[model samples]
Target chain A: MNRIAAFSIGAASGVVGTYLTLKEREDLKVEPKVFKYGRPDSPVSFHSYSAHSLAYDRARKIPLWVIERLSPHDIKKEITADRHRSNFQPDPFVSPHYSSANTDYFNSGWSRGHMAAAGNYKHDQKCMDDTFYLTNILPQDLDNNIDYWYRLENYCRQLVKKGYSLTVISGPLFLPEERDGKKIISHQVIGDNNVSVPTHLFKILLAEREDEEPPLLGSFIIPNKPVSDCPLRTFQVPLETIEKHSGSHFLQNLQRNKALDLCDKDGCKTISLNELTLYRYAQKLEQATSKEALEKLWAEMESKAIKLDKHITAIYKKKMNEF
Target chain B: MNRIAAFSIGAASGVVGTYLTLKEREDLKVEPKVFKYGRPDSPVSFHSYSAHSLAYDRARKIPLWVIERLSPHDIKKEITADRHRSNFQPDPFVSPHYSSANTDYFNSGWSRGHMAAAGNYKHDQKCMDDTFYLTNILPQDLDNNIDYWYRLENYCRQLVKKGYSLTVISGPLFLPEERDGKKIISHQVIGDNNVSVPTHLFKILLAEREDEEPPLLGSFIIPNKPVSDCPLRTFQVPLETIEKHSGSHFLQNLQRNKALDLCDKDGCKTISLNELTLYRYAQKLEQATSKEALEKLWAEMESKAIKLDKHITAIYKKKMNEF
Candidate 1:
């Protein structure tokens, strides 16, 4: 019985090896060019392909088990890390660690700039926060990260209109350090509490349109200063707070109504001063500085008349024209 | 007349502006993911396809001009620099320039290695040599290049049975600095004194066989030690002497036979014996005392009327048995 069992094991091993060899041979036969380096009987085969092709193929071939395990956070992390590995530096504004004193450029007075605006993401914090990975960080002048940055953000928003989802990662390759020292990392102070330094940042927008081929990647480097504008920005609010406050429900509503297109649907126009007062009271509750202040603000707003439909229309129209 | 010329120029400018705007819009339509980081507007696009797809799509989208503009030597340089960049921290066998000279082990020891080994590719020198660049350099041990590095010098006689034109490049990645305390670019020594170091090597085989790919790349990594009873006297000789003594006709014949699989067929096959000879003679010459000793060694084999054909047959049989 033992002898028979040994024989069976040997036979199974032989069959497995033979099957693997045959499969490899078939693959080589189908595309001889793939084995241009010559088959070495190694487990891993090396072949050269373009970055875009690799990404698409990988996305398709990812095992179901792997996909099942991935969350929105996981997907965001993987995309963020991959972008960083490919040389995307992080934006400092959204990164809490940058403001930490332990970093190389603590309090260096440089702002972390995001090529993708936080608001355009409907203020999703995880998406915004992913831009804080070091690989996504790059140095930018303060003015450039603030002023022209908004323009570029608007440009990306415009791209969404044309059925293209923009995935932008941009930053300076090098930065001047302390006037004369070898250029080191830089940092930004956030809300008078935390300091941050970002090395690289990226924003990836998955396509919304059905007919268009989704953009699988994108990157850019901010040119050296002396030019008028680099056009990048740093977010004022923490991405987490923004994401929680904005909520997925609000985003869904915006998309459904084509709020991005700045249009309103179902004109059931009505106004109630009491409703307006209630909305202001809720807003005050969300933004109150202290418990006492919050109570006072809410009481003041609640006392006033509230209007709903008229206010919504006015705000919606104003946002539509702004875009 | 001046006013009419000014008007015509203004009309042309307007047309140009219209064209530029249209181009910008087309660019904006591109997904942001496709853009490379440093070069936002670069025209070059990269894509990877499966070997099968690549085979089917071949109208040779890679332009002839582009291929022509890039020399194998230039590519080698780029590849070498990239290897260094990727492997900034050198490993056990591969030492950095700063670390190589500091080691005492390499001085008294000889490694039993393949002059044209596949593993040497990570170092870049093996692939750059002209002789080892040939396809025929096969599974050689350390003794072959160090002590018997000469016995295998005329192994080309064994190649005829394989029914392929073998191209080989063999040379060293480093030439010891002549003066103490002087720095040397260990990877740049392609040839020296009309000859080149032959420690590093590569091989390519061009044969029309059912299983053989038209172009193939392989290499070997010779050990840093000497051995006794060097089974084969595969020695190195001075490349210049190999060409001058072998005669130009012999060299020309080899080139013509191997020219069928040029990297860029349309480009000129400008053979340089300088690079080829260095690679060919590296192992043999390293072991030989002088050019006379090398020639006398070959003459001895000729006088013996060596059964080169029989030896080649035996080698092939041996290789087949391994498989």
Candidate 2:
């Protein structure tokens, strides 16, 4: 692989591009178009494209994990409208892999869910279209897809708005269940080719900075079913658990000790919905367009943020002590 | 949750039964009938009964994992013959869990294969019958069920015959597949309720001895597809991989380190069928009953065992050195 010379476009500090490192290329079974920040020779930092950063399982025709990096520029990208419904198609790049066809989802109760969410790539039409590749989607429960999982996706983007460069890996899992006395794969399947419904969906978030400190990791494993608007922390698990389930390790190329070990044990949080009232408020703040509306949203946001911050701080403190 | 008194029957040294420990009882979302060996107050060891040792997922009426232990005496019991084919029924215990019915497999083109092998418990009618529960079954590839997976099950029992007490945990996994460039659950479903077919099945074995050394762990994650009669080591994966995919931890209750870390890296075994020819010989010897037949089987077994012994010893020695 040749190293392409660094080029800047539009802004002085632009979205940099990098391909998979030699080590990652050797480790991955399928080739992916991985785009990262800085020059081809620079130390690996945050990534922007997830078209090929996935670990593909050829027998199953699904990725074990999909990774994407987001920054403030990504969250503010507004050049394109959401045309995911119209533009959904098979990815032209991954041939012979035999990804699921669009017709396979017809009449199936599950909604076509995104793994590398489209909203995170709305800045470039090409990037947004890339997210529509069938390789980036999983069969998700309708209620969980639109209401809960989507909210979690937005929250990840919000963190980017708060200036944190993050690397996110999201995927599906088929956990075992006991029937008579033995554990077996027991879940619903849709269509003739057998599009399996995921028992659970997991997302792992890592905060990376230029500093020497270890990255702070937050991992979650949520059931792919209707769930209440409880605090997101309810589903947090350890990075080790997510790594084990996906059969691929994350941030392995960046060797550093874990700064915190979260949800390594039982008794994860399950707080009341009242604690997440600010989350609902944040949704409304996003829609405020006029000057009057902006002023009113800011007033409401300030009041709710104070209350929610204290509540969330207490919850995080207790979880920290538990860890 | 009450502690029932231990009971013994038939032999002077009885098969001791212990239910799910209080710790497992608390961690499990649904109750299972777990039976452990040794005194009620002692730490959990090799489990004999899996009725409650299962980790059940209510969304999908299936267990995450099942554990069982066997002895030579336990294997020799011939009180009952295999009645699994005719005695299948829905588990009455996992109500609201809504396990699949027999009709689901009627025309699905897949076999209702048991996660827990019935032959292992054939000596006792109740135990053998328990293996027929629909919860203990999964939709498996017909050829794989009858040939590949079944052979692996017998091999575990063969290990028991060699005087090694083992804690065996077997479960199913739903791996992700990409369709149209999107990672989705891709597998076949059967019947009206869409009982899903698993992409793979995993079995983890921990050989425990009454010695100071750590237990030997053997893990296999086999695809739910047609397989050849090759060395079983071809499918070996790290125990950590199984735990991650199943979302449940084994041997967590038992505080000990692994005797050997197997398959944690690349270069896992993919030996030829010639090395495993003794396995076929053993299967033939199992069918021998008459004096002439036993003599003929013994003669053939001696020849094959000698060759297999050298081949296996060399493979094991290489593996041990690498570990």
Return the top candidate by lDDT.
Answer: 2
lDDT of candidate 1 over B75-166, digit per residue (tens): 23333422223221111111111111112212222232333332223324423231121111222234445343432323322332234334
Q: Give one digit per residue, the lDDT tens place, for model 2 in A1-323.
A: 11112111101111112322223212223211111110011000111132224433322334446667776656776656466443766543333223456776877778888888887777766666767766577778898886778777877776677566777778887665555544454456555445556788888776545543565567899899998877778888776555434433455444336554323321223333443455555555455455566556557656654465664444434443443
Q: Name the weakest run of 10 consecutive residues (lDDT summed) in model 1 chain A.
A: A59-68
- Tens-place lDDT per residue, model 2, B114-225, is 8777877767666667667676778889988867787778777766675556667777887655565444544555554446677899987665546425556678999999
Candidate number of the best TM-score:
2
Superposed Cα deviation of residue B271, candidate 1 (Å): 36
Q: What overall lDDT, based on C-alpha atoms, would model 2 receive against the true structure?
A: 0.54
Q: What is the lDDT of residue A198 in candidate 2?
A: 72
Off by over 4 Å in 1: A1-102, A107-110, A125-130, A133-135, A141-143, A147-150, A161-226, A229-323, B1-323
Candidates' lDDT values, in order?
0.26, 0.54
